[model samples]
Target: MSLIKTEELVHDYIRRDEEGNEDGRIRAVDGVSLNVNRGEFIAILGSNGSGKSTLAKHLNAILFPTEGSVWVDGKNTMDPDEIWDIRETAGMVFQNPDNQIIAQVVEEDVGFGPENMGIPTKEIWERVEESLKAVGMWEYRKASPGRLSGGQKQRVSIAGVIAMHPKCIILDEPTAMLDPSGRREVIRAARALNDVEKVTIILITHYMDEVIYADRVFVMDKGRVALKGTPVEVFKHVEELKALHLDVPQVTLLAYELRKRGLDIPDGILHMEELIEVLEKICR
Candidate 1:
């Protein structure tokens, strides 16, 4: 069964007058339909203004669909009574970490989520410790979020969401501002959350390298689902991705260039190691 499901979802931002009349409307998310299964790591990919983030907001019920329905853990998002319950089931991590962390200390920051849920003090502490440990930030639990790196702070923000025991996590360009190493840390932490803690992950990122490990990838455009498939399957369509104004990973693009020069390389060479191995085989 799917943890998150959307059927013909549509979201529009309407310009309103002071008299409460609709003037203009822009369809940011248009007729998007997708499903996310429990424990599955999914990637939502698109260039900016593609409605990827808009679509992501639907998963956590942050933005209600103007048309169609979204179901989180079997509860409809359009239903008012199910809003909080739906959000709790699918936690969200945005692009900026600094805006999310409020507590002076890391452990306290992580504990805030469960604390808000009214978990007992004892259980909240337990959850904080467990969540911090899972993200490899247990040693820094007492440190202030301001002192941490962008990656570390992002991990703390993730720990906060995980502390709530959410069934699914939606990360919208979480590593965009980080350095390469920071991006690695965030991706590693996200993968650990899926592999170790068995949490469903919906990662929205443009780094094609990141999508290689995802169980599935959905590409968005003009507020609609433009492409969808496993990483290999999706990346296989290099021309289509290019048409969408997206690029493959550096390694993948290099391999594609080599292939265009009539080399015996494969389509969608995602990582450096893969490219090296393929070159070695061709030379042999």
Candidate 2:
């Protein structure tokens, strides 16, 4: 069953003059229709101003559609009565970990969501522990969040969301500001949530490498979905991505180059390991 669905979704932002006079409307998302299945790991990719983030806000009802509808776990986002339930059904993690982490202590911050939801104290603690452990942050639960590395802090932010026990998690460029190591850590934790916890994941990122593990990818362009497929299927359009002002994974680019040079390599080589396997077969 589809955990999230959008029907002809359209979102428009009103452009205003400096004097605060009404100007015109700019369509941020235009007639997007898609369904995300339960337990599916979906990635949305796009360059800036392409509407990826605008589309993500609709997933959790952060932004209501201007011309269509969004449903989260069968709850309509337009319904005011179901707003809280819809939010709880689909949690969101934004790019800045520092902005998300509230409590000074890691454990306290992780428990904040459940605590706000009025979960029983005992269960909240259990969730706090498990969520931290899920992100490999249990050992430093008592430490100050300020002292944690960028990656560790991001995991704590994720743990905080996981503690809410949402059915689906939408991460919008959650690793955008992190260093390479931090990006890997946040991505690893995101994958674990899908694999071990069986949670539905909708990840929005510009980094092609980050989407390699996604079950499916949707590439957005000018407020519409320009491409949709598995990572291998989507990465085959290396030049297309470059044209969109986006980058393909390094290994995929290399494979594309080799294919251009008359080598019979596959189009979407995701990683060095996959490329090595293909080369080994060719050498045999």
Candidate 3:
């Protein structure tokens, strides 16, 4: 079943003059339609200003569509009465962890969500424990958010969302600010949540390497989905992705190059190991 769905979604940003006079409207998200199935790990890829982040906001009802509809867990985002319910059903983790982390201590931050939901104290603590452990941050439950590393803080932010027990998590460039190691750490935590916790993941990132493991990938250009397929299927169009000002996984690019040079390498070779195996086969 689709945990989230958007139908002809259109969002426009209205520009105003200095005196607050209406100038014009710029369409950020234009005619976007997609479905995210329950328990699926979906990646959205695009360069800056391609409307990927705009689309992510609609899923969480952070921005209502100007023309179409968005439904989260069968709850319509357009309904004012269902707004909070939709948000609770789909938690959003933004690029900066600092903005998301409220409490000083880690456990308190994680518990904040459940606490706001009016959950009992005992249940809130239970959720905090479960959430922190899920993100591999349980060991630092007593640590201050200020003291944690970039990656650790991001994990805590994720745990905070998990405490709400949302069926799906939308991460909008969650690792954009992290170093390579920190990026790996946060992505690992996201994968764990999807694999072990069976929570749906919608990850929006421009990093080619990150989406290689996704069940499916959607590439956006000019506020529309230009490409949609499994990772292998999408990466197979290396030239097409480049035309969209996007990059494929490094191995996929190398394979594409080799194929161009009259090698027998196949399209969409995602990993170095896969390339090595194919090269060895050709050598034999």
Candidate 4:
């Protein structure tokens, strides 16, 4: 059964001018239907303002569909009784780590969620240890969050979510504010959560490189899923993605260009090693 499902979902809201005048209804998410299975790592890619983030908000019940329906973990988000249940089932990590990290200490911040849920003090500490260790931040557990690097801070934020023990986590552009190393750290932590803890991960990002690790990829455009497939399958449409102003990974782009120049290369060369293996075979 699908862990999360949306049926013909539509989210619309009125725009307002600075003078507080209504500027009519704007459709941010238009008739989107999606199914996310348990423990699957799904990536949603889009340029800014494509409504990918808006769509994600629906998954966690932050925004109700203007027209359709959203079901998370077999419960309808529209049901008032299921709101907290849905939120607890699917944790959310936003773009800014600074905004999410509440406590001064790393371990304290990680335990905050579970504590709010009324978990016992001992259980909360145990959860804090495991969550921080899961994100490779155990060594810095007692350190002040303000003293950490961007990557470290982001990892702590993820640990905070993991401490909640949610079945699924939705990250909306979690790497956008970090350096390359920070981005890698956050992505690695996300992958570890999916692979080791059997957690369902929904990674909403614009970085093409990040999508390569996802089990499935969804490319959004103008409030709709313009493309959906595995990373290789989605990246195969290089020209189309470019037209949509999206990018492919560097190696994929190079492979595509080489194919165009008649080098007998295939499309969607995701990793450097894959391209190297193919080139070796051709050269031999």
Go through the candidates in order and give the clash count of each. Answer: 0, 0, 0, 0
Q: Note the residue pairs that clash in candidate 4.
A: none
Off by over 4 Å in 4: 16-23
TM-score of each: 0.98, 0.97, 0.97, 0.97
Question: Can you write out model 3's per-residue Cα lDDT over 124-242, one digit (the tens) per residue?
Answer: 99999999999999999999999988888999999999999999999999999999999999999999999999999999998999998899999999899999999999998887888
Regions of model 2 farther than 4 Å from truth: 16-21
> Which regions of candidate 1 fall more than 4 Å away from where they truly are?
none
For all candidates in order, the CA lDDT equals 0.91, 0.94, 0.93, 0.93
Q: Where's the lowest-lDDT run of ten residues in candidate 2?
A: 259-268
lDDT of 4: 0.93
Candidate 4, residues 243-271, lDDT tens digits: the string is: 88899999999999999999999877899
* Per-residue accuracy of model 1 over 159-238 as CA lDDT, tens digit each: 99999999999998999988998899999999999998899999999888888989999998888888898887888888
The local lDDT score (0 to 100) that residue 216 gets in candidate 4 is 96
For model 4, where is the 10-residue window of minimal lDDT? 260-269
- Give the distance in Å from residue 14's predicted Cα in candidate 2 to where it truly belongs: 1.2
Clashes by residue pair, model 2: none
Error of 1 at 263 (Å): 0.8
